[model samples]
Target: MIARRKVLLGGAGLLALGTGSCAGRRMWLDREPKLPLGIDAQGRALWSNWSGLEHAYPASRAAPASEAELAMLLPKAQAPIRPVGAGHSFTALVPTQGTLLSLDRLEGVVSHQVITATVRAGTKLSALGPALAAAGQEMVCLPDINKQTLAGALSTGTHGTGKGITAIHGTVTALRLVLPDGSIAECSRDERPELFHAARVGLGSFGVLSEVTLQNRPLSRVKKVVRLVDTDWVLGQWPALASQHRNAEFLVLPFTGKSALITHDVTDEPVRPRGPDTDSQTLMDLKRLRDLFEFTPGLRRRAAQMAMKNLPEEVAVDEGWKLLSNERPDRFKEMEYHLPIEHQVEVLREVIARIERDAHGVFFPIEARIIAPDDAWLSPFYQRESGSVAVHAWYKEDHQWMFKLIEPLFREAGGRPHWGKLHSLCASDLAALYPMFKEANAVRRSVDPAGRMVNPFVAKIFG
Candidate 1:
């Protein structure tokens, strides 16, 4: 229920008292974590993900400027040739000891034809928006974070929220991949269809995507609305809300008995550009509340409820591309799963109850969204409409509770883990979740017979 302005004003007083003698120990326990070595003993530089949970010191790094250069380097580079984007993923997908392949130099809009644009795999979603807008086109869907490269987004099945909108890979009509053997392969529904299906959500195991053709739509304006509401009411009305809006999602504030409902719809209204970000400060405010009242659930709920009451709704009119994705500056570890749409509400109820009952140290909001199904063999949403639930922990806090308390619920409900997020499932578990898992792994093996792209994590996933 806490709005940006109100929380800023109220937090100033609470924060001052929070640092006093009574809460001094809590502040010390929440300080920044000790950093890893900047450079290892073997002279390899440290490469870490955004959350700082995953890192590696590869023996070599390559930034090839052109497809020709990338293809030429692939066959002979060090083993476990891993491609890295912006390092936004929390999982171990990007960490490798042999070679860190960067496609940063091979980025831009390659070509356009009305509603379609061929983009370089290294093009970040942030840059791709304006580039596509210049041609009067935009992607059909975009993930919540725009820092990831096109290849990274597609490979990991990144998605946005909507009733019928699929993940980013669903819009990919065709793609060019540079195989481990240095051979270039072009695939689509009509050409090499098997490879197309297997590699769309490839997790960077089959090969590195060089270029992708996206099925897009005309650039248009949209209205975005954010309102605070009772968590139970929102949960009951979610199906209707999702169907009514162009896009819809919600954030659950644990111990607060409230949630933020966000929706977007196509609009023709005059532009009222979005305001500066207040989400980061609001998150920190929640953390402050947790630190002060962690031992008293009743007091925590009352404080948050009192602060959030009767706040004004926030609205903005802008291009869909600008409004959909967000800038997340604070770092955290996350675990997310996509489950059958019918099971979402029930599972979410359990998640919230479990967290509120046991995880008093939790302060980050739980996120929920809906995604349409796609045919990509490895995609979590394959052949079934899915509603996703994500739980987070501040980077410096312990995340073992997610695996111990939440993962079992997801597994029991037949949920599939997000490829880029945290989960404990292995190849056998995955094989049961995805109907095409065996075939996808076979295609991966055929393309990279020597396992040149396989890291320890990838091996565990494909075994």
Candidate 2:
């Protein structure tokens, strides 16, 4: 955690004292956000996303235990049938006035071979790690958060960081999908190739995924290292850093002029297991700093720099899976876009400068990552190496600034928004960005002609 003692040192102590007067107001802002009623007037129960940014009271909820059960539910249960996983998505992809189907009961590893594993779509990445480890195998990559189910992660094109690594969907060799009209279609590069290409990152609109086959690697240990460095230095050195490490990513501390550079690589060193996570506490500390110095950028930057100045780097050696993903207890709304690799550094520079200049109430660190290209038709990283930039706001605060100030930059750089994150793009805008958009939509129509799987948000996206 950012050292609180160091933050209170010297002249910064006065600013901390001054904040006491506004305690009542700040407390109100810090309180849990007002929630929607548990039961809506229609008598439907509430279902909300992890960040509480999106919610709905589906007319019915169904958890299917097997492919047969899911196939039976899809055709006749309701129109606009939507499948939900861990509700990790910030967008309204899962909300529906009709049936809300869940795949939680359909979890676990189905089978495995030397370098591949077939898994139930509902298996959480958390459970998948150990299950795969038992077979001496592991996923080629994993996203930053592990709570999301296999289906959710793949559908949204969720990814991890590395120069050569692709997103989770890129590792998929085949999939079994339960279509809207009670038919099952098993697809891969050779069998039903069009469907496979279109639905790999289909955003749940193609159909509910039942099973997935992943090309995995032998389970191995990796060393993780994290250090704080000047933001400018990181910006200049990012390309080399990304190439040097097996997995590399960084968090830019807004207003602080510092960045946390995290890297991981295969190692034979003795296990030095990661300690309890201090990231959440450190995040809240950043929030406190924001509250205290919303108007005084200099002091906020100085105090943060002081606290972070001499802090020791954090290191751990563990199985790749355990160290690759993290626990994110603090809820926040996010907007992320994947851009052409060459424009990443220039875009990041603008993002940081813009946040520091105008988005004063922001305290969340900006995340930067790299993903190699994939053949998944709807994937943000499709056909080109990409670098991703994500911005966040506390769940209780307004995130409109991201759309207003940051999204334009992303769009102008020929970026594509992460399928499940916040974005304002419609069908036309997306068509221009994705070369295969029209063909993918045509494939979607062929499978679900009646549009039984389309929700309002999906409609806007697939028009």
Candidate 3:
């Protein structure tokens, strides 16, 4: 199960990926009158692009510089407005026909109370990490990629690979949001408690998030020990591996049963020699080399297995944000589901068998990780032990065949799909899995009754 990681290494900032999904995204680039008097030009008001899919609204793109600007914009905003950060999520959470706001210039670290950071919604995770490190602090957890905005990550419960910790949203102690009625409010456990719980992982369905206060930790380097392990060994030792590392993830290749595990931990030893982040080009070259000879999937799989043999033993470095994240250059459609922690390995094994047997025409490493439950109302890991299984296929692959073949297995395992990734689950599907769905909806109703925060995707899941 040797997993290829080009998809995981692409770093933050979706707009820069130039995958061309947001081609109409240029509409908001023009100044007012052309923008404000009526629905604007070249770009749709709001849209979402991940891998390669787009859903946009004609009048939904709006960019507000301050809370006051956002307040003014919301009242005038069309009914289906939504705020966007870096557009990194593969989900349709941001697309709308009403108004899509970008807070690109609304970034900066506002206040630092020791380990706590109050940052504007527009701040990028990449920028936040270095700033926090300067203050001797760092985010406790983040996704394998750091390109998302602070507010966006929290909104969708974006997570990192860790045993007991939930996603990065779990770090939020407080938040400031603009309601649908153009009113602003601050939420926290001690503040507006109900709003705090729902809005923490609200999936941009409450209102425009203005700013956030993150609970951080002192900056420290992690020791990443990379090793090659057969799939059977990893499966048997997964429980122990989960206990051994603070943050752990494993990738299993499609054709081969061989697997490789990447483990990261804070270490006392100084950094060691590390390689560049771009390995996809090299792998692509290797694949092209063998494919010219008309190699079989089994042969291609063996070639990948051989590549890992001489791989670097460990990457020990003092990378602040860089070390904690990945650069996903390869474009791929992804669907991730979270089930009870006990069910993770079993679901994975079955998924592998199905893919291997059906030859579903999907290629990429199936990612597996563990995340403990959190109190966030809409978080998939809420109220139970959780395990996240990510099913990804290369962009050019036939998704219809692959996704069709995979969906049934996930359903049988009682898996909860990540809100910002891909999923077929609707409100009924989500409602049953998360008993608090109605309660979370209630919290959302109190804040944004106008549904200004919704788009087609959000409406399907939350309405």
Candidate 4:
């Protein structure tokens, strides 16, 4: 404990002794790379992910208006046909030189039966929420960001924070996929059980999901509350806190020694919609603190504590769909891992200590959320309930430190990387982490024997 305090104090003291000029600080903090041209040398239009960290110039780009159109194009398109959703992923999964397939035209709810809705895979969650509401249904859980397509979110095993709530893939009852050979297949627990489990979290390597049937619940309102709390206290009480709320998560402010605890619970209260977002403003404030006080660690800590302490809690009540998902205009590259429930806090503590002692430029808060277990073959939360830790770097920054420092800690704690996020694990490493990795790979190979769906990144993962 004394050593940890010394590290924190040492960081602040260095900031004080090595104070740099304001102009120099501004230049350093705001520096960013110049964006490339809209079109490449061959005149192929440029394509980039949400964070602008990954891009590719595909030889051909196709937007299939219907499943029939996709089926006809998949077998003939180039070797390594890749599907592009909203391009929200930070990894190289979407980058391919062969073919970029867009499902923009094939969207919306295809059909509905009581509590279940069969929606086209291309439908965006932002649009699907209202469509489901119109049909008197809503997804049981949704990821914090609603920009992802239903298929993309499921493929990546995206999730929201909540007790007893699994990732979106858990809600999938059936799926229709177009194999690399231009053949279509449908899978459910009752039919093609192996394929059902394997392809549910396929990471876009098994096949392209064309349609999905989700088990939804009746639309309802929820109350959301966000409050600042002492980081140490919250960390100690997290397990109990999580169990007490319907949905719960927290964001730990790196230098301030505090965290924002956010929770959502079922409520029938009158609509008291949330106000304009202040998250971006708060993030910038933290960055400014880093920039201005890099040389004065003590002053930085005092200033942050003074500014954040006693702030009023944010409260809102509205339909669960609207309040649960957020519109994240700011872009950042991320690395997240889901670990065994018991080790989450220990790993988080070590990571925070490492950052305070070493990574001085990091301003983004570390996000902590819990997830119930699921049966998806590649799911990080396979058989045991999980606690996920996600660290992010601003889009303009380099995340090499994440791979060098933090990833090793997570790996040591029996963590599994989020498929669409940054990680250094390969096929052999992943096989050791997941018990069903071999089975999933076998299913993928049977469907895509010619390797039409395998890009260089996917090859490294599935080799």
RMSDs, each prediction?
1.6, 1.9, 8.0, 4.6
Tell how far residue 56 is off in model 3, in angstroms. Answer: 1.8
> Candidate 4, residues 149-198: lDDT per residue as tens digits?
98899988899888899999999999999988888999999988999999
lDDT of 3 at 181: 85
Report how far residue 330 has shifted in candidate 4, in Å: 1.6
Better model by lDDT, 3 or 4?
4
Residue 251 CA displacement from its true place in model 3, Å: 1.1
- Ranking of all candidate structures by their TM-score, best first: 1, 2, 4, 3
Model 1 residue runs over 4 Å out of place are 1-22
Pairs that collide, model 4: 12-297, 15-294, 15-295, 15-296, 16-295, 16-296
| C-alpha lDDT values of all predictions | 0.91, 0.90, 0.72, 0.86
Q: Model 2 over residues 1-463: C-alpha lDDT tens digits?
A: 2212232243455546547755445777777889999998888899999999999999989999999999888988877799999999999999999999999999999999997999999999999999999999987589889999999999999999998999999999999999998889999999999999999998998899999999999999999998888999999999999999989999998998998889999999999998878777777778878888788899888877776668778889999999999888889999999999999999999999999999998998899999999998899999999999999999989899999999999999999999889999999999999999999999999998999889999999998
lDDT of 3 at 435: 74
**Per-residue lDDT of 78-188 in model 1, one digit per residue for the tens?**
988999999888889999999999989889999999999999999999999999999999874787789999999999999998999999999999999999998999999
Answer with 1 or 3, whichever has the higher TM-score.
Answer: 1
